[model samples]
Target: MNEIPAPVTSVGKTLLARIEDRSAVIGIVGMGYVGLPLAFAVTGAGFRSIGFDISPERVADLNAGRSYIKTIPANKIAEMRKGDGFRASADFTEIASVDAILICVPTPLTRHREPDMSYVVGTATSLQPHLRPGQLVALESTTYPGTTDEVLRPILEKDGLKSGTDLFIAYSPEREDPGNINFTTSTIPKVVGGDGPDALSLACALYGAITNRVVPVSSTATAEAVKLTENIFRSVNIALVNELKTIYRAMDVNVWEVIDAAKTKPFGYMPFYPGPGLGGHCIPIDPFYLTWKAREFDLRTRFIELAGEINTMAPYQVVERLIEALNRRQGKSLKGMPVLLMGVAYKKNVDDMRESPALKLFELLEARGALVDFHDPFVPQIPETREHPEFAGRTSVSLTTEALAGYAVALICTDHDDVDYEAVVRCVPLVIDTRNVTRDLQGTYDNIELA
Candidate 1:
């Protein structure tokens, strides 16, 4: 192991002492899912934090002590504002005063399925002029390896501020599971990787204050690869079970029951449930970051490719099951059949609908001439999103026995906790459950069918 680089310059030493004393001013760029909670964490640790966002509306809401995310409450933001612990801004000039800056921007995939790093690159370009010596910059976005060193390093150093010597750079991927009650920003272990010793030391010191544990690795690329590996593991496991669902169904076996039995093993077993498809920011999108980068080495990520293919096709499979259930119950095709989709926010309890398979399933059902209406307690109206602009006017339908009875079939896509499964089984004539949400009502409802 190489010795950690000692802070040689006065600016570096001053910044390190401020971090130790909890007097460091922290700047969090991109105030979305990952950045908002992180800004709160840093401020809660007694550091003065500023949250930056490109959206003026988000900045205004944050400054007014209102929270857009469901998991984070307005009271928490109010608490941060009470003591002047945190403030939200759209000004890039504030970067000059901050001792450490953490970039938590989005990295989406292009229409061609390649890495679209425009947000990350644009942020770096905007912050380049305001960057000063001795400020530690860490990227928390999920992207391909070498993004920190290759993409951000040059942009920062373009104004003659060296990375390791004059300034510091690191990559620390965000592991935010929205609606997860178990772990939080402070409780989850953070992985820190740096370009060199100085960057590593600074990153560990900064993140060590916010999180319970900080796992330091050798280089920035290793840290990037760690995040991709975790998501790929999930993607591949989910794909396996999704494929198995079809096989077991053909054999007249319940896949959910098999998973319950297989999970009984005390060792070498971790259960990953099958769903309509993958959702959330990390699982559906992160694995492909590696797949795109692997092509540079003339190699292919077969597992990732296979997982993408299977997961991508899951929405179609769910629609097919719904159609089959409808035909069996009413002896009619999907044409003119009214179907109620239960839950549209991808997963339970969270309002995030990024890459949600439910939308795709809805589209397929609509194309087949099925009248589709959805009900999600978390989401009131479907917002106009980049990937799903066509669903803009759609609003959540009220769930009631009388209203549900009017539908031909109720398709369970998300299985949110707020939904009454018993009521749905009793009211709807035919029910297609993709999430095994009606497992408890298994032999009770004659019309219930698993997808």
Candidate 2:
């Protein structure tokens, strides 16, 4: 997983020695899904970790040993609070105290679907004044290539601490799958690249402590490209399957059945199911970063852009299917009808709702004069989002026979295992299943409709 590491310089040797001795203080900026778990993972590797965030609410919640994420329990936070092993703060002045700083901030897309690096830029600017010699700074945010060398190196080195000589800078993308039980921060392999050989050595040494394996690469741009490439692969494949789902449905063929049988080949086949739309922090948004950056080289990422268009149109297709179902089977119009939305979280059983398709479905249905209500066990109350601020403060409705029977149809956007789908099919007059979660009950329930 590593080529020959550069011979440690005097400053690099000192930090390397601290990393081996379990005395290194690790600072993780941004205390959201990626940062919170990563800080604890560093602590688990026997280093004291300081979590940084701009939100007072987040800082306060962490200080009080409260866990806002469902995957991370409160007991875990309380355990981290037993001593000075872990603590969170909003003060960027403390950046000078840490041996290494890992940036895990958000990199979202703007209204134009361009890379929005405000969080990363702001974090780098805040910590630049406090950056000291002999310290290491590694970015873990998923970004386009050249971000570490082009964006951060200048701002961090602005205070006269030269990279590789006075300090070190590197890029190591975060690969976090929110609800996957099979993997954790410590178990997943890390991919690291640096501005120079010295920066690579120091950053690899830092990450080696937290993860079981460390994959060292040549440059920061390469590492950044690695993350984008991974998500692009998924985005393209999901789009392919989604397009297939539509064509197969028109021919009265089941896309899920085809996938299930095709996967039995066990070679040259990987199954990626179609969903209402792409979701989470990565797949739906990351591909467009490459598309946007391609403009620099006068390149058009037509394939990736096409995939994005397909996925983006998926939510609208769901709305159309719902409308068609209501008009044809029930002889009723979609206007002024009650529709129950199941699973508002981006994925199954996760509390995160970043870029979820359910939000778009809500907007589209409501715009068509349909009354919409959602039920998600994980997300009890909808928080304010930049994209869908109108949904803020709305709470999840109850999922029961009595509650389900009131709605004209139940549309399943996320296939959360905790949901009683059998009961949903029985209680509702029509059920639109986008996830194929009701595959087993497809024939048993005549009311089920696939979107």
Candidate 3:
């Protein structure tokens, strides 16, 4: 229902020229998983990039050429800091200095499972006073369909700088996959949408310089919808596989084997493996944005709601499997037992633990009187998080054979490549493989049991 804005004014044309000429100073707000890689990509494309974060510590680390995220090396940060290519700041007043601004803030959900758009709105409001002509702003945060047009545009236009005229605005959802070595930020296709033709053209040109492919959509809302759709598809598919895993387990059939066989059919099948549960910044959270927004139209997102329900229960199912395996194999109870949890991060090779099902398993195990210890090569210690503060003091235990043998059972929550599965199977008395990490050694080890 949102109307398109006017054509590009002289100010927008000047900004476009600067962007095309590679002289534009690119500013990335919220230098976390998404923004940091983007800043690197922009700087690598021969444009000056400035990273902005509210955390002074993060700003200091980036300014010192130190990498906090594991995927981005300190050497890369040092290389970017070597001239005027990249810098980090906590000051919002410096927004006026950048030619283009990319908002990459988080859009998390409230306790009631509604969209919490405070980060996006707050960043837009903070940049309002610094709004000027000949500057382009693009929001790269994932959200509901109308967010770029409804939530951000009004806040950005409050300073008398009209979008597409005195200023330009666009929505380009970020496709950053942290710890994914197969695809870098530059390799992922950038999807850009805007209020009008000029904004779209400018956004495409700006992102096109960094990435190999730039997909331009008609409206900003459409671009926002694209990100939601992609994540929702993943969430639903993962939920399906997880649900099937339970059914297959009940029937004495291995779901991993079924998936491996089904994936060979190239025509109509796309393989999505089951896991502990959905994690990271996107899959578990982004789908609810659409679920909340759909209620406005008096429509129910049954699939999204169902997928959320199933995925949320996957960790509990894993715990049940562990309990069942322990009771049947060793005639042991969970209470007072020492259990080793392998890999605490959501996925392998990354330190991010946001909404990780492994944390849920840890909490559940402790509640059931199981003494739990975790081992993750990437995460040395559990940091204090907004959601799981109780796990703050826990640190990663060693993965030696001596340490593994001391535990009553070992649960493979995440299949990190560095973990020696053979040693784990040999040392641990009972092994609950939630990730099917020991599939190759299914018959070799008497202790290894797949969940």
In lDDT terms, how accurate is model 2?
0.92
lDDT of candidate 2 over 102-213, digit per residue (tens):
9999999999999998988999999999998889999999999888888998999996999988889999999999999999999999999987888888888889989999
How far out, in Å, is residue 294 in model 2?
1.0
Ranking by lDDT: 2, 1, 3
Model 3 worst lDDT window (10 residues): 1-10
Candidate 1 weakest ten by summed lDDT: 1-10
Please give the TM-score that candidate 3 achieves against the real structure. Answer: 0.98
Ranking by TM-score: 2, 1, 3
RMSD list, candidates in order: 1.2, 1.0, 2.2
**Runs of candidate 3 exceeding 4 Å displacement:** 1-8
Query: Which residue pairs in candidate 1 have backbone atoms (N, alpha carbon, C) closer than 3 angstroms, thus clashing?
Result: none
Candidate number of the best lDDT: 2
Off by over 4 Å in 2: none
